[model samples]
Target: MAKRFQIFLIVCLSISTVTFMLLWQGQKNNKDDIRALAQASAADACIQFTEYQTNGCESSYWYGVAAFRSFQQAYHSLTEGTNKAANYTFCNEVYGCLVLSPEISQSNISEIIETMSILSSDVEDENGYIRMSELRNSLTR
Candidate 1:
């Protein structure tokens, strides 16, 4: 009985230690993980937007809208606790785009496609955050 109890306690301690280490590691990389996810979402949105532009299908347009929303949500999550001016500005720019006009002109579609392409390119570069700031600047202008 004593031997069994000793083995059981050792097993429990090992499992708890592993769990704690995993939790600690996850916490350490939480921000990086969120950034990666947001980048991926942005890329997806860009692809969807491009498809809409190429196909000119109503469904494709809706898909692009949905993907853009996902990208926005992920970005918002990444900046939730921060009070950065750039973050707010970027969010506002994204929100303004989200409010679609009933009739999208060709120029507006071209601009959206161009913006999404820039955003997706950020995912490929190491300086994605800086690129995103640049995107905000372009949008504001």
Candidate 2:
């Protein structure tokens, strides 16, 4: 009976420790993924801005869409786990943020990206969905 009790305690402690570590790592990864998203979008903004400068609004819009598609394609490559739906939702939120800003110019992309970085760092739920109910701007999409 004594040995059985000890075994049960050890098992419980081990599970608790592992669960804590996993949650901690998940939180850390959330931040890291958001940072990466900001960086990639910033790079895309530069090219898209160049397109806007050289060609026109239509050209820049298409270029921006393409670059954003690339970002979406690579986004999944950055993360892995049971939280894929959450990640997708988070990504869509950030994508909406990136596109529909009031000031969507070359000079403003950095500010937008920075805002995203700041917001994403703290927007995740315990389940990893970035359900930012209090966005600074109302998201129509």
Please give, for residues 1-141, the per-residue lDDT of candidate 2 as tens digits: 999999999999999999999999888666566546744653574567456555657667556645654554455554445456556555566556546653443334443334334433433323223332222233433
The C-alpha lDDT values of all candidates are 0.63, 0.52
RMSD of each: 5.1, 9.7
Q: Give the Cα RMSD of candidate 1.
A: 5.1
Question: Which candidate has the highest TM-score of all?
Answer: 1
User: What digit string (tens of lDDT, one per residue) describes model 1 on residues 38-134?
Assistant: 6777777677767777887767666766776676776667776666546546655654544544243223556666666665666434344454555
lDDT of 1: 0.63
Off by over 4 Å in 2: 1-42, 49-56, 82-85, 93-137
Give all TM-scores, in the order shown.
Answer: 0.59, 0.37
Clashes of 1: 0
Q: Which consecutive 10 residues in model 1 have the weakest lDDT in total? A: 98-107
Report model 1's TM-score to 2 decimal places.
0.59
